[model samples]
Target: MMTIVVSVLFARSTRSTFPSDGSTSSLITHYLAGAAIASGVIVTPPAVLALTTYVLAPSLRHLFERLLLYPLFGAAALVFLFLAVTTWKPGPGTPTSNMDTAASLVNAAAASALATSGIIVTTTGILASNFWLTLYFDARRCHPYDHIVLFLLGTAAHIRRERHRWHDDNQVTIWRASLEVVAVQVERDAPLSGRTGLAEGSAYMELRQEARRIAAVIRSHKRDLAEAYSAHDVDAVVASLVVGLRAFCVGDRTALLAHAPAEVAPRVGRFARTALRLIPATVLIVAGILLPLVPSIAHSELASNLRWYLIVMGTITFITTREDLATKIGEAVAKVLLK
Candidate 1:
C-alpha cells in the first residue's frame, strides 16, 4: 500500500514540477536535477524495506506498538518548540552547537525515514499474509479515490496560481518589502485598492512596479537593522522590532494584511531579529524532534508536541501570510489588548 502511494506521489510530483527547461537558467536546471536525484535516492531504501518486510512477516499478536519509549519522541519535540519560540539573541555554543545539532538532525531524519519504510512494508505484509496475496503483485486501498483527490487538489492549485499570478507576485514583493513600510504604517496601515481602472497588462505592470517601489525600503531597512545591532542600542532594537513587525502586517496575497490579533502574530523585529530569534528557535524546535530519537535522550512526548506546534504555526502562517497592513495592525492591536 505504501509502495503504491509513494510511487504515485513521485510520479505526480515529477510530472507536475519538472517542466521543460528550454529557457530556464542552468542553475535552475541543476537545482531541479539535484532535487530529482535526492528524491529518488531517498525513496530507494524504503521501497526495498516495504517489499521485503511485508513479504516475509505473516502474523503478529499486535499490529502496532505503543510503548512508553514512544512518548519520549513527544518530549524532544516540546523542548525544541520552546527553544524555537523563545530564541532571540545569539551567543556562544550557538554556532558549534548548531553545527552538531544539524548533523544529528540529518542522521535522525534518515533513520526515521528508514523506520517508516520498514513499517509500511510490515503492514502490507500482514495484510497480504492474512488475506492471501501473491509476491510480485500487491493490492492497495482506494487507489482511484486517492488519485481523484490528488487530481482535484492539483487542478485547484493550478487554477489559483494562474488566477493570482500578479496577485502572488504582489504578495511576494510585499513580504520582501515589509521593512520598508514599518515607519510609514506605524500610524496607519495602507489601504486596499479596488481594481484600478486599467487594462490587464497595464495593471500587472503596475503591480510589478509597486513591488519595485518597495525595494529601496527593503534595502534601507536592512541597513538600519545592521546599524542598530552594531550600536547595540535599545532604541534601535525597538525601532527594528517596530519595522520588522510591521512587515508581518503588510499584505495578504492581495495587498491586505492579517487583521485578526497581534497575539496571533507577534512580529519578529528584523532580519537581524529573525536570525537572532526565529532561526535558533527553528533549530531547537527541529532538534527537539531529531535529538530524542537517538541514543542520547530520545523522548516520544517531545515529538508529539513538536508535531502539534508545527501544525498550529503552519496553519497560522498560511492564513495570515497574505493579509494586508491594516488587517495586521488590527490583529496586532487585538494581540496587545488580549495579552
Candidate 2:
C-alpha cells in the first residue's frame, strides 16, 4: 500500500523531466522500459540465489528451499495507475496566450507521454524496493541471501549517467536560459504585438513553452539533489545546491538568483540525514542477521508471530532507504569484482 502510494507520488513529481515529442511511440517506449525493469526486479532474487549458489558457496541453498513460503511478487498492477497520472511538457512553439485546437491536442499527448516515463521510473524503483525487502526478509526467515539486487537497481537509477540525461551542465544552462526568457516575458505584461495585433511568430509563445519545460527540469533537478542528500553525496549536494552568486553578466546572476527555490538549498547535514534514513533499515537488517544466533527466540511462538510483521517492516524500510549508502557499497564491490 505504502509502496504504491510512494510510487504514485514520485511519478507525479518527476514526470515533467522525461524527453517526449508528444507522440504515442515515445510513451510506449517508456512503458516498455518500465515493464522490463519491473520484470527483471521480480525474477532477480531467485536468479541471484541460483547464480551465487553455483559460483560461490552454497550458503544460499536454504533460501531457495523457503522461497515458496512467502508471497513476494505483485507490484506491476499499480504501474498503469501511476503512468496515467503523469503530466508531460508540450513542444517548443506551443502557444499559452491563446489555446489553439491543434496545440491543445499536442499538449495533451505530450503530457501523457511525459507521465508514462515518470510512471515507468516510479514503478521500476518500487519493484526494486520490493526485491530488496524480499531479499532481506527471506534471509531473516532463515532463507538468507546477499542483497546484490539493491545495489544493482540503485546504481541503475541513481548513479548511472546515461539513464538521466537531464543532469548535465549544458542542460542546466538551457533550463536557466528558458526560465530567464519566460521571466522577462511575464514582466513585460504586454502581448507580443507589432503594428497591428499579436506577431505571427511571437517570441513569447516559444518562451512560454520553453518555460514549462524548464519548470519540469527544475523539479527533476531538486529531486536529484534530494536523492544525493539521502545518499550522503555531499559534494554533489553542495555543487548543485550552492548556485554561484557570480554570473558572467548582471542578467545571468539575476536569473540564477531567481532559481534559489528550484535549486533547493541544503538544510540538514548530509551525514546526519543519511544516518537517520539508514537507522531503521540497519536495525531491521541487523536484527534479521543476529536473531537466529539466539536460539530461544529463533523458533519460539513469539518469533513465528512476529516473522510476518518483521518482513512487512523490512519491506517498508527497504522502500524508504531507496538510494542510501548501500548503493555506494554495491558500486564499490562491482568495481573491485570487475577489476
Candidate 3:
C-alpha cells in the first residue's frame, strides 16, 4: 500500500499536467509526509525488528541457557547504547542572530517535545518487549507473530509516549497526590487511636479531627504545604499531635494505612483521565504530520502544537485535581468497607 501510494505520487509529480509554480513544493511536502506516515503506521522498521527480537529471545534462553546468554545480552545492550548516542542531537550551534535565536528556541522546544514522545514510546516498547521477552523465555520457542506483536505494541507505545509528552510540552507542573504524607500524619495519631472504643473515645475522634484539619490545610495552602512536604518538613509541623507512626501500623488497628483517607482515590482517577486525553492527541498529531492537511503548514509545526497541547493538559491535570476530596471518600470505602 505504501509503495502504491508513493508510486502514484511520484507518477503524478512527473506529469506536466500539474502546475509548475509552488505546486512542486506542495507535492514534495505531501510525498514526504505520506512517506513518513507510511513508514510510521505500516512499514516501521523498529516495530518489526523489535517484534522479531522478542520472538527469538525466548528460544535463545532454551538453546544457550543463562550462562551463554549473558554475552548476547551485553552485546545487545551495547548496541542499544550506541543507537541512543548516535541519535542524541546536541544543542544548535549557539543561536547568534535574532532569527537564529528564534529558530533555535523553536527547535529546542520541538526536540524536547519529541524526546518526551520518544520516551513514552520507549516506555511502552519496554513494557511490551519485556512482556514478550518473558513469554519467549518461558515458552522456549520462537513465534513470528509474538515478535511482530511486540514490535507493534512497542512502536505504537513509543509514538504514543512521544505524542503524550508533546501534548504536555510546556509549563511543567510539579504536584503529587499528597496522600502518602497524609498517611504519615494519620499514623501519628495512633497512640490515642486505640482510645476511641473506651470512655476516652474523644481522643480517637480528635485523631479524625486532626485528619480533617490537615486536609483543610492541604486545601487552603497547597503550594505552601507542597513545598513543606517536598522539603520533608511536613512531619515536623504535626509532630506534636502525631505519636509514633510505627505504633499505628504495627499493633494499632487505627493506623492510617489501614484507614487512610478515601480521598486519594479521585486524585489517582484524575491522573488516569489526563492519560486518557493524551492518547488521542498523539494519534491526531502523528496523523496530521502524515497527511499534510495544508501546504503552508510544516510537519514540525504539527509536532510543535502537539508539545504545547501536552503542556496544557499536564498543567490542567495537575492543578484541577489538587486537594481533591472525592478520593478521600473512595479511599475510606476501599480501606474500611472493601477490606
Compare the candidates by TM-score and give the number of the best one: 3
TM-score of each: 0.20, 0.20, 0.22
Tens-place lDDT per residue, model 2, 1-339, is 456555655554443333334455654555565456545544566455455443342222334434421222232333344345544345567666433433444433444433443454555556667777985777565311012222223322333332244445554443333333323222222222322244555665543343333333334454454344233352453344233212211224245335433332322433355457668766866675567457887876556434444444554565556556555654554454433
Off by over 4 Å in 3: 1-236, 240-244, 248-251, 257-265, 269-274, 291-339
Write model 3 residue lDDT over 1-339, tens digit each, in one string.
234333433443332232223344544444354334333432244444444443443212222233223333333333333323332322566444444333333333333333333333444445556766896685456431233223323333332333323223231111122223233233333334434655677776665554544343333322433445222343332331233233322444344333334433212333245556556545644553544444554444454454444344344434454435534543543354324
The clash count of every prediction, one per candidate, is 46, 3, 25
Quote model 3's TM-score: 0.22
Residue 111, model 2, lDDT: 42
lDDT of 1 by residue, 1-339 (tens): 456535533433332222233323433444455344444444454454444433332111011122111222333233323322332232444576454443333333333333343333445445545544432232243221222223223322332343333334443343223333332232121211223433566775544344333332333443443333232332443343433333433433232122212122223333333245445446545654565566534454444454444443434443343447435654664454433
Select the stronger candidate by lDDT from 1 and 3: 3
Locate the minimum summed-lDDT window of 10 residues in model 1: 58-67
**Which candidate, 2 or 3, would have the higher TM-score against the true structure?**
3
Instruction: Answer with 1 or 3, whichever has the higher TM-score.
Output: 3
